[model samples]
Target chain A: MKDFPYTESKDTRSGFGAGLHELGKTNPNVVALCADLIGSLKMDAFVKDFPERFFQVGIAEANMMGLAAGLTIGGKIPFTGTFANFSTGRVYDQIRQSIAYSGKNVKICASHAGLTLGEDGATHQILEDIGLMKMLPHMCVINPCDYNQTKAATLAIADYEGPVYLRFGRPVVPNFTPADQQFEIGKGVLLNEGADVSIFATGHLVWKAILAGKLLADKGINAEIINIHTIKPLDARMILESARKTRCVVTAEEHQMNGGLGDSIAQLLAREEPLPLEMVAVNDSFGESGTPDQLMEKYGLNETAIVAAVEKVMARKTK
Target chain B: MAQSTASETHAPEATKSVAELQQIATQVRRDIVRMVHAVNSGHPGGSLGCTELLVSLYFKVMQHTPEPFDMNGIGQDLFFLSNGHISPVFYSVLARSGYFPVSELATFRKLNSRLQGHPATHEHLPGIRIASGSLGQGLSVATGAAQAKKLNGDQSTVFVLMGDGELEEGQIWEAALYAPHHKVDNLMAFVDRNGQQIDGPTDKIGGLGDLRAKFEAFGWRVLETDGNQFETLLATIKEGQGLLGQGVPVMVLMDTQMGFGVDFMMGSHKWHGVAPNDEQLATALKQLEVEKASDY
Candidate 1:
C-alpha cells in the first residue's frame, strides 16, 4: 500500500480561519459572526481584515445563531463560529427554528470538536454534536479530516445554498490531504485500496485510521481506508462498495458510538448490505480534562483502537 | 422598491387617514378572531391586543412590498414577528395587507396551509422571513437583517415585535446588548406590553421591571406608545423611523390590553393562547365593527 505522508501538522480551526479570510476577500456577501471566541476559533484574521462584515456577538451563541439566520434574508451568507458544544447543544433551538427549519443559508463552523478539544473537560468537549445536527432535516453535517480538507470544505460550502454544520477540531494533527483538493459533500475520500477490511473514518480519527492501515499492512492484512466527511448525506454508494469488496467493516470517528459516524454506517450496512462490523468510537460517555493524545488513547480512539476493532471484526467475517 | 409593489393587491396600500386605518384595523381584528375560532385553536388574546400595531405598520409605517415577496427584502423594509404566538394578528395583517389571499386566513392552523400556528418561512409564506414560534429569537434575527441592510447600503428599516414576557429569555438581552454596541440603528423593535403571558401577568410571573429604563440603559433610543390606538402609535412609529441611520437602535414599549377589542376576552391571560368557541366567537365578532372592509 502507498503510504500517505505529511511533513507538517496544523489545527483544523486555522484552516477554517484561512478559508473564511479568503472568503471575506472573494465573496462580499459572506459575513462572519463569532460569540466572543475569536482567538480560540482562529477567526482574528477574518475579523481584522473584514471588520465591517464581522459581527462580534459577545458570549451569546443563541443570538449569534439567530443573527446568522437573519443575515441570510438579505442575500448574505453568514458563517457562525463557536465551540462545538456551544454551536450545537446550547443553541440547538435557535439553529432549528431560524437556520435549519427556516432553510436559511448559515454555515455553523464549529471548532474544538470531540475529545481532541484537549484539557477543557467534558463541559466543553461535545461528543454528541453529529447526532444533534444530522437530525435536522435541512441541515448538512460535515466533519472534514484535516487542515487542507477543512479549508476546502469551508470554501465549498459557501456556494451551497442551505444550512450546513461544518465540524473541525482544535488539535494540530497530520495535514495529509492535498492542499488543492476539491471538497465534495457526501463524497468519501479513498486513502487506500485493500481487500481484507473496509476502514471507514471521519474527522480527527481519519489520520489514526491511516496509521491503522499501515499497521494492518505490516500484519499481511490488506485494509481499505475511506474518509467520510459528510455524516448527514452519507456516501452510501462508496461505503457499500468498499464494504462489499472487503466483506467486513470498521467505522471510526472522534464521537460517541450512540449517534455518530459509526452509528450511521451500522444502520446503512444493516439495511442495504449487512456485514460484520466493529466501531472505534466512545461508547455513550462524557469526556474529561486531558491532553489530546491521552484523551484519544484512553477513549480508544487512536490507531491501536482501530487495529483492535479491525481484528475483532476480522474474526467475525464470514469465509 | 417598497412603494412600487402592486398597492391594490398583494401589497401594503398607500398612506391612509387615521379613520381609514382604524377601519382596516377593525377588519383585521375580525379576521384575527374568525381565523382563530375556525380552528378552535391559536392565540387570540395577544393577537387582538396588538392589532393596532400590526395594522398600523403594514398600512402606514413600513415601506414594504407584499406582492412577489422577497425573502432578502433588499432595498425594502422587513418585519419579523418575534412574539409569534400572537401569529393570529400577524397572519391577519399579512393577508389583509396583501402578502397572501385574505381568504387563506381560514387555513390558520390547518395542515397543508401556509398560515401555520406559528410564523414560518418554510411554508413559502410571502411576508414571513424567518420561523419564530420559539420566543426571544426575533430580535436577534431583526438585528441581523438591519445589519444586512446597512451592509447593502439599503436605508430601509427592519422592524421586529416581541411580547414583553419574551424579554425574560436571555437571548433577548444578548441581542439587546449586541445591537447598540454594533450601532444597529436601522432596526425598530417593539414590545407588546399587553402585560400577560401563558401563565399569568408578566410582572407577576417574571417581573419585567422598568422596561423604558431597561431599554434606555441598553443604549437604545426608547419610545413608549399606545399600541391600541392608530393615530398616536402610528405617529410614534414614524418618529422612531426618523431616528434610524443615526448610529443607534430604537426600542418602543407599546401598551395595550390583552384581547383588546373583544370585551369578554380582555384583561385576562386565560385568552393568551385559547381560541374562542362558537358562542364566544359570535360575541367577539359583534364587538368588532368596521364600515369600510368586510370579513374574508
Candidate 2:
C-alpha cells in the first residue's frame, strides 16, 4: 500500500478556506463573496477575520458574480464561491459580461465538481465545468489536486491579475504535495518519470495516477506520472516533452472525456506531437447517488482503470 | 451597514444646450438606423427611442474624463447599457463624447471591430465599464459598482438602463433586494419601458404588471419621465441625481415609444430588431431633420 500521509483527511474546501483566510491576513485587497455556500466553501475563517471584506450574496449566484466583478473596479480582489453548476452555467452570462469581457480581477472558486459530489447526482455534479470556463477568453482555469495544492492555488489566484476559475472537488484526496509549495498558474509537475508510458492527470485523479505509477513499476512497466492541474493554458510543453520520451500517453481525470483533461491532451498531441493515447474518465454518462468510491468504479475513473489504460496505450506505441 | 456620507461633486463647467445635444442624439439615431440596415441584423427600435436619453446622460448629465480612460471610473458618473443590442446609439454617443474616434462608428458590427453586435468592454471600448447584453445583469453590475464607489469614498453615481422585458430576469430582483437592503443609494437604474420586446408587446409576452409599484416594493424611490422629451428627461434625471444616497436607490421609469423619432418605424414592436432599408432609411432621416451639428 502506498503511504498517503497527513493525519486527518480534510476536504479541498477547507484548503480553500485556509488559503482565503491566510490571504485576508497577507493581502488587504482580498475579499470573499459567497452565494449561501460559506459553510460549504469553508469561508468562515475569512468571514470571521475580515467581516467587512466578506460579502454574503445570499443564494444569488448571478448577483454574487456581478458583485465580485464590480468589487474589482475598486482594486479589491474578489473571490466568489458556489457549487460547480451555479458557478458556471447558471451565472455564465454574469461571469461572461462583468468579469471575463470586462477584464476584471475576480476569482471564481467552484466546489463540488465531478462525481465526487455524490448523492446529489447529476444535478450538482458538473463534469463539463472545465470546458465551459476554459472557453472564455482571458479566463484562467485551475483544477487543483489535493488539500495542500488547493490551498496554494487559492492563495495564488488571489494575487494573479485578471479573471480566473479555480475548480476544486467535494471529497478529500491524498495531501502529498508539499504544503508550502508555491502554486504556479500554467506549470505542470512531473511526479515520477518513466519511459514505457506517460500518465497525464489532474484533480483527484492525480493521486490515482501516482498510485498507478507505483503499481505499473511493480508490474515492470515504467510510467511517467505528470500532474496537469491547470487545464487551460495547458502545460503543452511538459506534456509533449514527457510524451516524446515515453511515445505513449494515458490521461486521467474525474470528469467527462469530452471536454476534460484527456481532450486537452488529445488536441495538443494531434497538432504538435502525435502519440497513441488512452483516457480514464467518465464515458458519456451522468453520476448517480453513491459513495465517491462507488462512483469512481462505476465511472471508470480509478487507479485500476489508469493502469489498464497505460498498458493499452503502451501496446500501440510504435517507438 | 455603513451609510455613504459623500456628497455629489459635479465638475465646474458649462451646461450644454438642448439643441446642441439633440443634434448629437439625431446623428446617433442615424447611426443606429444605418448600422442596423448595413448588417440587416441589429436592434433599431429601442436604440432610436433611447437616443435622447443616452445623449442627455452622456453629454449633459454625467461628469467624466474622455482621455486616459480609467477602469475604476473614480470621480465620474458611470453609465451601463443593460439591453446592449442598442450599441449603435451607445457607440455613437460614446464617439461624440470623445470616448473614441467617430470613424470607428463605420465598423460597428464588421470584422475586427470594437463595436460588437452587443456592447462589450472586452474590445477595450473606453466608455464601457462592463459588458452587458444578456439582459437583467447590468443593474446588478451597476449596483455593485455603486457600492464600490461608496467603499472607495468616491461620490460618483452609477447609472444603468434596462429594457422592460429584461425585468423578467430574476437576478434584477435579486440585485434589487440587495441594493436597498445594503443602502446602496449611490446607484440609479432606468427602465426603458418602450412597451415592446422582440417577441411582441411586453404585456403580451410576460406582462410586467406594475413597474413603478414593483420598484417601490423593492424599496426603490420610483420616478417617471418621458424619455423622448429632452428637457423633461433631463429634469427627471436631475431629480434622480438629487435623490441619491438618501437610504434607497432611485429607479427612473422612462416611458418611451419603440423607434421614437423614425417615421415608418415609430410606435410599434415590428422595428425591434429589423433593419430599415434604403427608402425607409431616407424617410426616417428626413423625419429626424438634421440639427446644426449634423456631423454625420
Candidate 3:
C-alpha cells in the first residue's frame, strides 16, 4: 500500500469554486451561472471577482441550461452550478435538447451529489446523475475524488469543447491529491500497486478505498487502488491492465450499484476480460436523513465495506 | 468564417412590395407542401399559417447573410424557430433566402440529410443557430443569444417564433419571466397564435387565456398582427424593431389560421402534423399557385 497522508479536510465544492475563480482570471471566455445556490455551491469568490461574467439565474435550472447553451453561440464557455438532483433530473430534457444534442460547450457543475449530502434525504441526494448524464451522446460525465482533483477537473473541463457533467459532494473529505496536479479526462489515477486485487473507486468513496488498501495490506493481502474519476469515456485500458495482473476487481462509489461505476466496470470486464468482481455501493433503495458517516455505513459505502468486498472478490478469484 | 458584423448594414428597406412578397410566399407555400409530401411526413398547417411571417422576416425585415453561413452571427440579426414542427416553412425560407442550394429541399427528413425533422445545428445547417424541436426551449435560447449580443456590443435583434400551445410548457413561462427581468431588450419574440396543437384545438385541450395580457404582466411590450397578412406582419415587425433597446423585450402575438393558404385545410387542428396525401397535395398546390413558380 502507498503512504498517502492528508493534512486537512475540505469539501469538493470549494475546490470547484477555487478552480472557477482561477479560470475567471486566466480564461476570458469562461462564464459562470448559478441557480440560487451561490453560497452552497461555494461560488462567492468567482462571483465577487467577475460579477459581470457570473449570472445569478435565480432558482430556474432549465432557463440556466438554455442560457448556457445560448452563451455558447457567441463563443462563451458557460458553467452552470446547482445541486446534483436539480442539475440532472429537474432539467434533463433541457440539457438533452439544448446542450447535449445541440453539442453546446456548457459545463454543468453539480454539487452535493450522492448520500454525502447528509440530512437532505433521497430527494436531493441523486445517485443516478452519472447514468443520466453519461447516457447523453455528447455529454462527458466526471466525478472527482478529492478537493485538489476536483479543482483540477474543474479547470480542465473548461478547455474541453463539449457538454460535461462535473459531479462533486458537499461533505468535507480528505484533501489528498496534489495541489498542482494536471487533470486528464478519461484517465485513471493509480494510487497504489498490488498483485492480489484491483480496487476501482470514484467520488467520495475513493478515500475509503485507500483506507481499505491499507487494511488489506495489514492482513497479508495486496490491493491495487485506482481512482476512476471520469465515469464516461472510462479508462478501459488501465482497468484491463490492472485486472489482468490482479485477476479480480472491486468497484466502489457513493451511488446506486445498478448504474454506477460498478456497472460501468462490470460491462467493460464482461466484454474484454471476465473476472471475479465485487461492488461496494448502495443497493436499489432510497436514502434517508442521517449523518454522513451513518448514511455511508448503512449504505455499505465505507472503507469497511470495501475491505469486505475485496476479501469476497479475492476468495472467488481462480488460482 | 468572417464575422457578419452589425456595421455591414442591411439593404435599403421596402425593396420588395407587398405583392412581390406575396408571390414569394406563394412559392414558399408550394415548396412546404412538396417537401412534406416527398417525405410522407411533417407538419404543414402551422407552416402554411406562418408562411407570411417567415417570408416577411427573411426577405424584408431581418438583416442576415445566408451566403457565408456563420454559426456565430456576431454582428447580424439572428432568428430561431421555436415552433420547430413547422420546419417546412423555416427550411423553405432559409433555402430561398440563399442559405443553401434549393435542390437540398428534396432531402427533407431523408436519410443523412441536413434538414432533419427538426431544425438542428449539429448538421452544420446554414441559417440555424440552435435545435428546437422540443417545445418551450427556443425562447430561452433566443434570450440567451440576445444577452450574448448585448455582451458583444452588437446592435442587432434576436427573433424567435413559438407556438401558442407550447406556452403550456413551464419553461416558456420561466424564460418569459427571465427575459424582461434581465432586460433582454435585443430580443423580439413572436407567438404563432393559431390556437391549435397536435392533439386538438388549444382551447379544447387547454386554453391559454389572454396571451397579450400575460406577456404585458410579465413586463413585455406586446404587439398584435395578422400573421397570414404579408403587409400587416411586415409593418408589425418594423414597428416591433422600433420598440427594441428601451429596457424591455417585445412580444408579437400573431393571430393566424392553422391552415391559411389552402382553402380546404383551414381552421382545423387535424392537419397540424399530418401530411397531405398525393391528391390532397395537388389540391393544396393548386391553391398556392404562383406565376413563374420555381419548385426545388
Instruction: Name the lDDT value of residue A287 in candidate 1.
Output: 95
Q: Candidate 1: list runs displaced more than 4 Å.
A: B1-12
Lowest lDDT 10-residue stretch of candidate 3 chain B: B1-10
Model 3: CA > 4 A from native: B1-14
Q: Each candidate: how many clashes? A: 0, 0, 0
lDDT of 3 at A191: 93
* Predicted candidate 2 versus true structure: per-residue lDDT over B112-197, tens digit per residue: 99989998877888888788788888888887788778767887778899989899999999998988888888888899999888
List TM-score (chain A only) for every prediction. Answer: 0.99, 0.97, 0.99
lDDT of 1 at B272: 89
Q: 2 or 3, which is superior by lDDT?
A: 3
Error of 1 at B270 (Å): 1.0
Fraction of true interface contacts that also occur in model 2: 0.67
lDDT of 3 by residue, A218-315 (tens): 99998999999999899999999999999999999988888888999999999999999999988898888999999999999999999999989988
CA lDDT scores, all candidates in order: 0.90, 0.85, 0.90
lDDT of 2 at B229: 95
Say which docking band candidate 1 falls in.
high
TM-score list, all predictions: 0.97, 0.95, 0.98
